[model samples]
Target: MAYTAEAPAIAAGDDPMVPRIGRVRRRVRELSDVWTLTVEMEDGRPLAFAPGQFNMLTAFGVGEAAISISGDRDRADSGLIHTIRAVGPVSGALTRLGPGDVIGVRGPFGVGWPVDAAKGSDVVIVAGGLGLAPLRPLIYAVLASRKDYGRFALLFGARTPADILFRREIEQWRRRLDVEIQVTVDTSGEDWYGNVGVVTALVPQASFDPQNTIAYVCGPEVMMRFGAAALRDAGVPDTAMYLSMERNMKCGVGLCGHCQLGTAFVCRDGPVFRNDVLRPLMAVKEL
Candidate 1:
């Protein structure tokens, strides 16, 4: 039977409709285009969230963007971390803010990765570009409870060596003997010394037992399709793999149909979905 995990509901004290005031605790320029912001709730409570869920960040006058929560879930006292690419007005504004600035936030909403279901299985994580941001928390969770799983592999692909999101952390993760890290870039300069190709190429080299592996993939739609195809060819069933999807989400609740993909709302039903549930919708380009 296919494994279709139900999306968990928002916890008590987390009202997606009510925007909370949060202060920017810190900001780090991750890349020329990407920035990581740490925010603390005005009330000093932690912004609790599961891995793969996102928050809608309001830039006061500019508007809002749905950004995935990228920090460690177990350390809520450290504040919520959002890694954002400044590609628009709102994101640009949010990125420009410094510490002590205030912003409107709603969420920690939507579905999350199936970490519990993946216990005892080999884990394969494939990420491309900024997609790594959303998947970072999952990696943290897996590493924190490393003994519960079998082999682990993380294959990341970026536009260039400079485009990699978490370079220092990737290096630290690489030092762990139990975790496998493979990095590749689409283009490279002389300083680069890594694989060069699409992320799917690294998929073939991952050391996971195909039948007993659970794969998590995030990236461009095209990249995800190819990654899913690669995982399928390697013997992973559709039900054992998942992907993250993004859409125009006006409201975090189900009332806004802006993020509807077929019957599923990217903001409500998922941002994370089992491959079997998303494959059909992905085929229709207009969705």
Candidate 2:
């Protein structure tokens, strides 16, 4: 299949650093602390995004936060979805917004997942906690083009059963015979019947040819490092493993240097990077 990159839509006279007004179409509370907001440009233009790009959302008086675009890439009319956890002031303001509320949006920035390159290869997706939000679009792209890939396995972990994001969608994916889904939690409750352990423990259970598999991992920095090691043990080479790196991003562009890791800028060079390129830098504590 031919892959064509989608050019980001910009309104006339719009500045890349300036935020455009967007209206909240709907808001769904996914978990106790997490909320998903569906927002559309006030002008009604479709917000096009690749599988792993993000947007800097601003609440009028509040500050801004870099949030991954979590909606289906193919459905432009459904608006952009951002699953946010109210952990701080800016995020708290975003979560407090309801349908019809207006907010500022300034992106579709950062390099996205290499879903196209993974075609014909077995794919392993590993996500922990809120990291799953960024990987959600990649999963949609993969499943939407299911025939183009080999086996698909998803291993996800969260704090507990209640902390799991997209519970309904996860259940639906689990019901699909073509997809393999395993979930784990750091701690389990009496209501939880699934595995009780770190997400890496479920990595060995995924059935994929290590040589033919491409892995995408996103989570806490420590969790990502461990997940990459586990994938390595499973036979996946560093070249075949990718990770999403999170950092303090003051500017969506590389000019600010806030999101820099060594010589690379997370906002411009990547939010997604192959393990081989990032492994060395990740080992450095100061960076």
Candidate 2, 109-201: lDDT as tens digits: 888888888899999999999999999999999999999999999999999998999989999999999999999999999999999999999
Task: Give a tens-digit lDDT track for model 1, residues 1-287.
Answer: 12334334555766778789999999999999899999999988777788898989999989988999999988979988999999999999999988999999898778889888889999999999999999999999999999999999999999999999999999999999999999999999999878999999999899999999999999998999899999999889998999999898889777978998876778877889898888777666554
Question: How far is 72's C-alpha from truth in model 1 (Å)?
Answer: 0.2
In order, candidate lDDTs are 0.89, 0.89
List residue ranges in candidate 2 displaced over 4 A: 1-13, 283-287
lDDT of 1 at 74: 89
Model 1 residue runs over 4 Å out of place are: 1-15, 284-287
Backbone clash count for every predicted candidate, in the order shown: 0, 0
Clashing pairs for predicted structure model 1, backbone only: none
Candidate 2 has an lDDT of 0.89
